[model samples]
Target: MSAKFLQILLIAMAATFSGCRNNSGDAHEGESHEGHNHEAEAKSEAKADPHAGHNHGEAPKFQYTAYSNSHELFAEADAFIAGKKAAILSHFSILPGFKAVEEGKITAILTVNGQESRAELSAPTRKGIYLFEITPSTAGKGSLRFVISEKGGNTESGTGEKGELRKRGNYEVIVSEVTVFADDHAPYHALQPEPSAVNTTVFTKEQSWKIDFATALPAQEPFGEIIKTSALVTSSQEGEAIVSAKSAGIVIFSAGVVTEGMSVSAGQTIASISGGMADNNPAIRFEEARNNFEKASADFERAKLLSADNIISQKEFTDTKNRYDNAKSVYDNLRGNFSRSGQSVKSPLGGFIRQLFVSNGAYVEAGTPLMVVSQSRKLTLTASLPQRYLPVLATVREASIKANSQSPALSLGELKGRVLSYGKAANSDNFLIPFTMQIENNGSFIPGSFVEVYLKGLSGTNVITVPVKALMEEQGLFYVWVQITPELFEKREVKVGRNDGRSAEILSGLQATERVVTAGAVQIKLAQATGTLDAHSGHVH
Candidate 1:
């Protein structure tokens, strides 16, 4: 090849090698870009926090020493000693309400037992307590869990022998009533929205027991009043006597027969039947004999007259007269019921016919069932009451009944029942002790319909009551949620009372005025169950 041609080939080969290297470099750069993007994403995710809300970030805590006994309460209107508090309360501190230090001196004034006792006032402590115990003053172990600074911040607190009021940091508290318990292990572990306020649940029975949940409201906060639902009742009835058919057989037709419940006059035939008609009414023979006897009787009468007039012998007259007597007897018996097969049986009383067993042109035999006669103008609702309610029934002075046929059974109803009879045999349906309620039905009540009853007997003074839905239960423990913040719900325990079967009674842990979770209680719990929320895990004073 020529020298010039050789040089041109070399140049072309060099250019091709350079092109291959550039392509390889471009491919590697694409993969490197993906790796860089992935690394950036990972960094962003790691910097974020899941538990951001609970990051109390070295929040000040106070220690609690004194407390109220945490005993359980049972039975209605039970009271607890004022000083007893729950052991769950861990610390007590006078967490500085406020020290108006005009020029830098702890110029705070703490009045103990109505006297100016010295205050070891200091900064807010780092402790958590169930409650606070007042100094051993004539206040009689009085407990104050919070204090207020002239400013506006609130301080959480507990019971103590002598409170050490502080001077610095956030502060404000208005201690109110303290909870007392009967048994330490009461189901008082109810959930609440705020840790400060304790609320209780009323699982069953009206006002059976009380849970002592002191509120943080001003010492003299007025309690919300209570009210009772109407009375309890059963089915509506017309008359006292409830009757049923005793025999069973094929029904027979009557002139004006109808099914059960068709009203008819007293004389109107409720039911009827021509029994044994297929066998040829035996009474037919008696009727024919009766006719023959009638003819013989006529002949005998004429013969008797002849005998008297000497036209016939005495023996003949006597024989004819005897034959007339026999025939007459037979005819008289047959005349009363010559054709028993077609004889009509009538009712004896005057009332509406309630039930019938026969139809026209129908045949029945002996002992066949006819129809039932009901004396009841109305009906009564008989209920099988549970034995657990025995005591409640007796103590009740009055009761009312409601029809259970409501769209969704509830406290509202047409309460129009009264007490009729009580202490009957067991009910046929539930087999519970029977309680008869004579419901004067003006036709509003049907005999076979079911109903529900609400009985309000003894009542206490009116107090604020919360809806049962506002309450929450977990692991046998009951509680409520306070709408502390728009999106946050604090879990707290409460004690409750009488159940209207609609709303639950609040005994303690909640204030009547405090707004609670009307719905979505479970949702709040699920959020808390993850320990994402301190829930009841942390301590409360």
Candidate 2:
């Protein structure tokens, strides 16, 4: 073979070998790409199927329930995982016979271990349902806290299980916890939109314990128009007596110690009066009169014997007899009252010594006004009312007296009294009509003490009422604290009608069977001003 032919053959063989090697490499790369595609497809399938290779084991299902102190409010939670977000479906309802809550404000929070995530709450729809969505940072052993605030047209605090919520002026907090699993591809059902919004104060059980709060239910009772006015307690004319000096003399207290307010009985000797050394002194007059009486009596007796025996003339015997009779009458009249020492001054009636006019060793003239004794068992209440109330004066069925602003009012029914009289016309000075009521004093009333009078007209139907202490006033507007729950209270505006200082009638903004804060209302007002108020924690069940 030629040399050139041999070189061409070698080149051809080398080229062929290189081409085969390249083809083999291409085949291997094609197999590797196909394997990678298959692996990716398998992974995508596993992720799409929720029950593929994942094992939940015996993990407890998520479940939660909530209720308010008001039997009318109820809530339930259904939790599940949806992709990377955790969704909670909340349903609320009112009892079968109660009025439905029109709308509510809702807030939700999710906590996993120590990590917390705020939830996006959807407004409630016509079905009264809400949905909460949260993208949990990490999934495993977590809880969801839900808060729902709702109000009715006539809703007030202390009316239901939402007590603490009412006090803090917050919505009812219904807390529920459920163990959940979190995963990016977890399967969860979708929920419809339900929109709502609310802001409320939360007064927790712990907070209530700190404040030492209490509550009471409102009641339906007989109520009437109350006419308020000022009054004066005075003594009745028949219940008073005046002691006066009977004659001119020096006064001396019978008991060494006689003071006002001392109890004395009828016929008790209060003092003694001794005549002074004057021309009209009773002691000297009695002595001189006695001497004359003795002389005249002896002369008359002798004359009488002579006349009967005809020993003296008739005219002389008659004159002597007349003188003796006259002197006898004088001695008899002064003998009982005129003693060498003094004359006794006694009380004619039994009562307390209300006043003392004469001091020890003081001189007093005859018929001079001295001291007054008052029987306080019976007293008179004089109340002045505006002329406008004159038409209802005769129809007044009840009355009460409060001695002072801080004192409790005493009712006429309890005191056993009635209206005695009323002025026919208004007074010239104040244009106020005066009315009097006689009261059997029970030792609680004091004469001359000013008081407040409440006169009630005829009773009407049963109405809601609360103690006066429950009311709070601001800028002439009246308000009250109603217990929403044991520890929760809400401030509410109220329209007040008749008030008797102890209790007031509610004409609007309050309901029967609702509870009110009879005490500590002022403290609540202060708390609202400082913004330190809180509501009870959401119920955990």
Candidate 3:
């Protein structure tokens, strides 16, 4: 026989003996005499074979390991040896970039004691995995090399080394173990909080110092229904006044630096008009009038002396006196105002420079406005409400005003203010009723600037209210942070009712006495999105 055929025959005979031993005890237990006879025949066959009674060495044992890029995909391999046959079971998952190998795509090379054997892949009970069997000539430590061919001509290869096998009296026992990689257990993906789940974010004492976090308790307070409307900040006619040019000339600013919003005192010379034609310039006209007045004065003195001496007629004396009086009146009018420069404009009131009508070098006609001075200490807030609200307008017990800047809104109860007046009838142009409230400006409120007015009515009892700063919005949904513990917070969605610019009324989702984050809410929102919150034991408030 050929050497290759002899090797195949030896392997087949070994497998036959292994199968007989497993079946012998079961069949012989039913009949003692028959079982004895069968055992005698098995012993005769084993004695006849030279390799039957000899130890061929231990059966091959395998250690299977698994690995994957993420927990979504898991890979495992089970390898063992039963009698003379070495079997390998490879399990794969269809992940994002990897696919399962087909029946003919797997090839394994098993090497034992310097001898190598190749086997074709076979299907297993489960899908997406494969199995194959190999027959080794001798028993020893073995290594399995596997190559899986992908449909796109790519290949994946792995090696199982230091594999051993052991044998028992009747059957070969195969042992397998598995291992997995570490990086698949990432914290962010593994420990994400569900949207509807109550998740507490832990802020350590050390981390809390880095953030400006503040909390306030929701309490039962007198919350009133607020009517919000746009309003205009204006100065009363008596509280504000404008400085105008008395004569037409070029405007020259008196101060080195003059701009709108600059504070000015009453009777202060803000600017002067100079450089005009002789007829228009008050300085030149005053000089000509003074010369005429000197001549008139001399004539009047002569007339008076002649009248006393009876050498001049009464009519002549009266005419001379009248001309002298007119000249003197004209000179006196120009004396105090005339200078080399021209007419000077003084501020009518002590206040800020509200407006500058003309530039420094610009020319102005007589009576042209130079600048507006306003006493900002007292101002008016005028709001136009829909005609339908006129019924409730009478019930407005308090009001507040908020500018479009960072300054906090001024509450009427804290500051000096009251509703001055309301229109008796709706305006014909906009069909909206106008209401006015007087306020003390306190240096921050600017005239003519638009502001928001909150008209609060009678307060309602047993209402939960929180500071407006405690609320945050995401995708049109309002939420607030409830302190679950001293250093932990949980986000909660809330339904909001009327807001009075300072405090907002909560209709749902919060209880009185529960502490909510009034500051640093944005920081907590960002931490929640990235899953950077540390884990801690927290109790709900």
What CA root-mean-square deviation does each model show from the true structure? 25.7, 19.1, 25.5
Ten residues in sequence with the least summed lDDT for candidate 2: 191-200
- Candidate 2 achieves a global lDDT of 0.68
A best-first ranking of the candidates according to their TM-score comes to 2, 3, 1
Candidate 3 regions exceeding 4 Å error are 1-198, 236-239, 245-263, 273-342, 358-368, 375-377, 405-410, 413-418, 440-445, 460-462, 530-541
Single out the weakest 10-residue window by summed lDDT for candidate 3. 166-175
Model 2 residue runs over 4 Å out of place are 1-214, 237-239, 255-268, 277-341, 347-351, 359-366, 414-416, 425-432, 440-444, 459-462, 526-541
Q: Where in model 1 is the C-alpha error above 4 Å?
A: 1-235, 239-379, 383-413, 421-435, 438-454, 485-488, 523-541
Q: Per-residue lDDT for 31-108 in model 2, tens only?
A: 555446767888898989856876644322233444555322233333444235544545454321122334656677
lDDT of 1 by residue, 1-541 (tens): 6999999999999999999999988877846554467677766776794333433333222222222221111111112222332122222223121111121111122233344222223332222122222222122222333332223234323322124433333333322333333332322331123344233221111111122122111122122222232223322333222222222222334544355655545454334333344344534555567678978889898997898899989999888888888888877765553234444444444444454555555555554545555545445655566666655555454443444444322332333434555564556676666555554454444456665554555554555566556777778878877654322356778887655544556667877556566545665565555544332333233
Better of 1 and 2 by TM-score: 2
lDDT of 3 by residue, 37-105 (tens): 767887898889745665534332332422222101122222333234544555443222123333335
RMSD of model 3, in Å?
A: 25.5
TM-score result, candidate 1: 0.31
lDDT of each: 0.43, 0.68, 0.67
How far is 505's C-alpha from truth in model 3 (Å)?
Answer: 1.1
